[model samples]
Target: MRETKEINALLHLIDDPDEEVFSTVSERIVSYGKGIIPNLENLWENTPDETTQERIELLIHSLHYRDLKTNLSDWGKLENPELLQGALLIDRYQYPEVSFNGITQELERMRRNIWLELNNYLTPLEQVNIINGILYNYYKLKGTEVAYTNPDEFFLHKVIESKKGNAISTGILYAALCQLLDINVLPVNIPRQFILGYFDPNYDVLHAGGNPAHKIQFFLDPMTGQVFTHKDVETYFKRISVPPIPTYYKPLTPKRTIQLLTEELSKCFGSQPYKQAELAQLSQLLGD
Candidate 1:
């Protein structure tokens, strides 16, 4: 079992009841005793919805294919839910492939271009300060609604708008670029709330976030068009009894990243199997 923080996070989402969560979990969860499977099965039997049933079945199939000691590599580059069948499906964020296509590419291109240009214009510090420039550009172009554009929304909407470049794509770009630029980053898919990011030299690990990275989270407030304060984020974290902390980077394996994304997809789409599997594979890549 990997003890990395991201691994811990990915494990947390197996129970997320979201499509993206399940999809992401599927790709990760490389280590286990099959304990989660039984729980998943029980949930499957109790789930009354057809989509849920489909998702539960597919997850069972995905689970059967692995066990402890499965070495994962090369899950590879993902296309949007547009080019493939998989996406973030079953979470509170519920994005379907049909919704994420157009947005993913645009965000990717934008991030890539920005990073490509930034090799000259700014240092990592300035880029961090001006980071909102990317966020504003993303939401403005997507016209992301306040209701669904939280952190998880980025995961779902990226797939929901599959080809058009949405938040998930934005995050993907953010993570990839940050890594390329030697910045520490992590994604928090807590619920229908803002997405939080962590970065600082003291807590940053070049490759993996161990137990030491002190992370702070900030999310955009669509209504105010500004970032939320600690007080604002604390209210939501309290719902889960998770007090706000400055150092919160949870290092996870590349596989876990995919699992988290898929788990969210499953929840969003009510766990439709074919789409769930498709999205899980597409979003499976997890590295710089």
Candidate 2:
């Protein structure tokens, strides 16, 4: 009770005209972590000063970003990082108020829909077709043509809520769902583009002396669920005047996928000063 009273008193002191006094108070409140967010939000709602409101907003963002840093560091320590969990951590960076359970349930519903249409007899292409039909045609999820225009398109929760996403977010969702269905879909690290590759599980060991491209069944564009061939990838390289490399056809780990997303997002955050450091921290944690 005494600590609560002390925190409340410090919050009220935020309106003080002296810069040093307010800075001291702000630093003290920030030490309380995300648990103090509700109290800060309530103070912001009740307060009328624009200057004070702005300070409160910055405080809230700092708290959320701090929590994200801690969580992401711990996630990186896992020997096998789960795809959806990493994506959700990225989501929380933007939407601290989002319901984790709600997003999980929503993903579960999508997985069940795909599960209903799948069977052991189905070919890999047929399996992908079912996911395509369900997500794009039935669920009406669409690709954001001007995706870089908005940063929200990169976040998984926002993508789910808006039914719109950029390449990385959509690719992550596709990969996550395929993992749940026991399909060996992986992210293809093609330069200047993000795509998914369906691969044979034993290709790594079986084809150790063979070409990695031989293991790739097909490439799927998560944006439109359009299937393309290796020839198409080569054509893409030719169109861009770049030589194709074997690594481009290889599967990316969950950590690498998130790293790519953050790298792409960093390009868009040129003007946003606050996100720059947080992204740098995340990128370093992911070994970028």
Candidate 2, 277: how far from true, in Å? Answer: 2.5
Give me the runs in candidate 1 sitting further than 4 Å from their true place.
Answer: 1-73, 76-109, 116-126, 143-169, 189-194, 202-231, 239-253, 268-288
Instruction: Tell me the lDDT of model 1 at 128.
Output: 56
Q: What is the TM-score of each candidate against the true structure?
A: 0.42, 0.91
Off by over 4 Å in 2: 1-5, 203-211
lDDT of 2 by residue, 90-207 (tens): 8787788878899889999999999999989988899999999999998899985534568899889888998999888999999999888778888887888888999885555224
Q: After superposition, how far is residue 45 of candidate 2 from its true place, in Å?
A: 2.4
- Estimate, for each residue in 1-288, the C-alpha lDDT of model 1 and write its tens digit: 334576456544655687786876766653443555666666677777777677666565555434211222222333212111122222212322233445456546655755654645564445655555654554343434333223455453443343233334444445544554455554444444424355453553335454332354444432222555556666767877874553433433334445554444444444355544544543443334
lDDT of each: 0.46, 0.85
All-Cα superposition RMSD per candidate: 14.5, 2.4
Q: Ten residues in a row with the worst lDDT in model 2? A: 201-210
